[model samples]
Target chain A: MSLDKEKIKHVAKLARISVDEAKVASLTKDLNSIFKFIEQLNELNTDKVEPLTSILNQSLRSRKDEISDGKIREKILQNSPKKNEEFFVVPKVVE
Target chain B: MSNITNLSLSEILKSIKSKKISSLELTQAYIKNIENAKKLNAFVTTTFDQALENAKKFDNKPNNEQLLSGVPLAVKDLFCTENVKTTAGSNILNNFIPSYESTVTKNLWNNGAFLLGKLNCDEFAMGSSNETSFFGNVINPVGDHLVPGGSSGGSSSALAADLTPATIGTDTGGSIRQPASFTGTVGFKPTYGLCSRWGIVAFASSLDQAGPMTKTVNDCSIMLEAMSGFDDKDSTSINKKKETYSKNLKDNIKGLKIGIPKEYRVDNMPKEIDELWEKGKKILKDLGAQLIDISLPHTKYALPTYYIVAPAEASSNLARYDGVRYGYRSQKGKDLIEMYENTRSEGFGDEVKRRILIGTYVLSSGYYDAYYLKAQKVRQLIKKDFDDSFTKVDAILTPSTPSSAFKIGEKTNDPVSMYLNDIFTVPVNLAGLPALSLPAGLDKKGYPLGLQLIGKALDEQKILNIGYAFEKNCGYKNEIKKWWS
Candidate 1:
């Protein structure tokens, strides 16, 4: 159940975080220790127990389709790291 | 009058109403205290100018209906303040200013409270110690080098140091209560969905809850009332009338059954903490409450389940933080993928990155059932244990932390040891219940130790009353020796 270096790197990639090669060994060690601690859950028999989706035990409440929140395009885009007049600027995807 | 900075919230409110003290003058005093306590690192941003301007407006015509008229309070950086930088203690959102306000903060403003500033916290409300903050570690006012228990560390420390009259903090698995415990202040985490989560940076949507951190239990009660209500924006927000908790805060605990969970008696718990728990049980007993031994066998699994669920939710929520949108972006990326990878790796701290990896690993293809699904089912068992215990007892009592505040870097290197700090407090969050930590006694080094009172869902009143009873009879004075001053 211990996480290997490859698995750790894969997880970092999946999370979109770039871990340096030097830190991979330590991260793998830490992840493996954590997994070892988490392995204690295997002791219990959860054959009939249902996974808890919500602690309140209620289904998601629906709201009517309406523009309750709008008119903040400029405000929302103000914090963008790289934005032009109307769109976010990014590296060329097509090229 | 005594120093204006040292006055309680009730006293400040009363003085402002009676025209004995101007709100502007009172706010200036608080601003001065915040300035003097700069070494504590309690604030991420100080809104002194805006606070003064609002104080002047409040002074022009004090609204009778406003419960917190002209009160200056600090908010944890987790809650967004419009036109103000809301960095949830992470460098990732260091520059992310919200155009809209968090519902809880909006409620506070509507009730006539002015923001002193946004306080520091654990990045994304993740850590138990404030050292994980990108702003650097918040020093505990109790001692020169101790950590103010976190996620809500800045909130608790600010209140303890009199830097702000009161502060608002969010609790996801003991973030609010633990900091309050470490800093000798009052912290309450209301029932999930009691306060709308809209605009607060989502860490773990299912577990994160907004509540009040204050100097006294009475302040905690009223502040929670002011900060909580139904919001159409937050899907999980319960549509219920806000209960006036301060009005119903009765100290009568006669005939009430208080449960002391036997499972909480873990191995190698400090003697002082064990003695404090016994003292707390004795206080309830003397107040005519029957003490019963109950069992929450699944308590041991709470931390592991929490680590699973929280990070799983965090990984999903934080997916929006790509370099293109907001926050920090790396300059050395070759393309979009490298930009995202580099931005996240550079923006997030080691603890945040670690959690995200664990979350991604668990929710990945083959490990989902073994890790994520099993954790969720275990979470159910933890909640059920509370339900079973509550059927026999009206409320539960336990030590707020395994130990009092520790040195800044004492447990930082070891993640597992740091996670153990929330052992006594996480089970409440798993059950979506209300809980509070109150100053009960001082440890050997004269640092404050807190006793936690936990109650069923929406039973904030019960825990508040029990806390009120204890505060009156426990005779624990949380007054520090003004080290920061």
Candidate 2:
């Protein structure tokens, strides 16, 4: 399994992860090996096998019988790096 | 040692009420253990001041029936504790601390359980080994430099080291159960949504569920009572009326129909695990549980299917970590896009990035039908296998992990080798079944072997009862620290 340096960067971009030019060489090797391992899984005869999604076989357990999230608003925003009275502040998303 | 660690939470609370051991004394003992057992690396962040303050509050409260009052407990780093750093084992969120507390944690704290610290885990709750954490991999205290299993590795490691009496952990896939298997403790993942996920960092949303890891089955049941409740904050939180889980600890194995799936007897299974499985079956048989051969034909697809679906969800869930609103922000670059890329690139570990890309690729428009859609359908089929098998049995039994804990750095180099560790356990998660891993016996290398019991939905009581019965007759009683040495 060969992962080109450029492909590593491309995958990183798609995945929203960062990789430096110097680290690209090693990541390529590691990523290729990972795919190779995944490749071994390809050998299994999963033709008729169904893919498992969740441990539970039931429909999603949901709650809508009521609505109340009491208190703790101040507790929730207290640790933010930047916070206004009731809002979280961030660098402007727009120009 | 005040013997509280050995005692179940029920017994610990009773001791505290009797004034035999003060909350302060118990808290100090656990803190001391954490300090001395540095190599175990269980705690990523310690909260001594918070623990003392909470202890005082417990002393003041009426406290009629809190199961874990003043009992020191570890919190997995993935769960957001108010004002605490919850990096989810990722460097990207190193500076990110939640202004909010996760519901499960707040529930535990409200029940007067003392907070020991935030336990280490795999990065973003990914990977099989604990090595993916930015804080450094947590070590299994039971072996010669063996690894604690991931995602919930830290909590399992802590309980094994007796650094904390109990810990809260998230099991997305087999994070809680497999690590518990490796560490020789009882790790339980309740029926999905029994514990609320609000303020817990999302990994694979559909699969993530927070549960307890403790030294014994009884402590697990006690902690679950406090940790579970309906939460509007988490859309998936089940609204079953809150009930004490400890009421189910009868430990009677009579008339229990146990299902043994033949598919788990795969080629990669270790010989010792086969012996251990036979031993566990014989014990249950001796206790009068009718063991029957069953089939879960979709078992072979669980690993591949889990990888596809979990990563698909992870790609979307992790998208919230851009450098904009919170967490780590890369320094100035040409534009905002560069900053986002740089920060994430610098922040995430190798395994996390791999999953993210893999998740994105599978979920992308061109490949969705082939990868993500196919995986979801297969997942339903896997659940169907369990449902079909459950009709013939009360619970399903299997080895929690194929082998006991391997040495630290043993399987980290090969991602697939690490993924295989979750093979037996992941299928249980995909089906959203309640499961528990308890110490069954020891491998030839003297490592602990864990036995898992998977039960149908909301059958947590059934599985816990079975596990408690297994733990009662297991040879590890009173020999935790000594047996490992």
Regions of candidate 2 where Cα sits further than 4 Å from its true position: A1-8, A25-95, B60-64, B478-485
Compute DockQ for each candidate against the true complex. Answer: 0.83, 0.38
Off by over 4 Å in 1: none
User: Candidate 1 lDDT, tens digit per residue, A1-95?
Assistant: 77789878888889999999999988888777777777888889998999988888567799788777777789879999999998999877777
Q: Each candidate's TM vs. the true structure? A: 0.99, 0.91
- Cα lDDT of model 2 by residue, B1-485, tens digit: 45566666667778888878778787877777778788777788999888877776666663746677677778899988877778788887888877777888989878877677988999999977799999998888776488888889888888887777788889988999889888888889888878888989999988888898888888888888889999978767777788767875778989999999999887868899999899999889988999999999879888888888888899999998876567777675566677678778777888888888778767776777666777777778788898899889999899998888888888877777888889888887787778998888888887888888999989888888888888777667424562232
Over the stretch B4-90, how does candidate 1's per-residue lDDT look in tens digits?
777778777788888888988998888888888989999999998999999899889888567798888889999989999999999
- Going through the candidates in order, what fraction of the true interface contacts does each contain? 0.78, 0.45
Q: Give the total clashing residue pairs for model 2.
A: 16
Best by TM-score: 1
Error of 1 at B48 (Å): 0.7
Q: What are the lDDT scores of the predictions, listed in order?
A: 0.90, 0.80
**TM-score (C-alpha) between model 2 and the true structure:** 0.91
Give DockQ: model 2: 0.38
Question: What's model 1's lDDT at B102?
Answer: 91
lDDT, candidate 1, equals 0.90
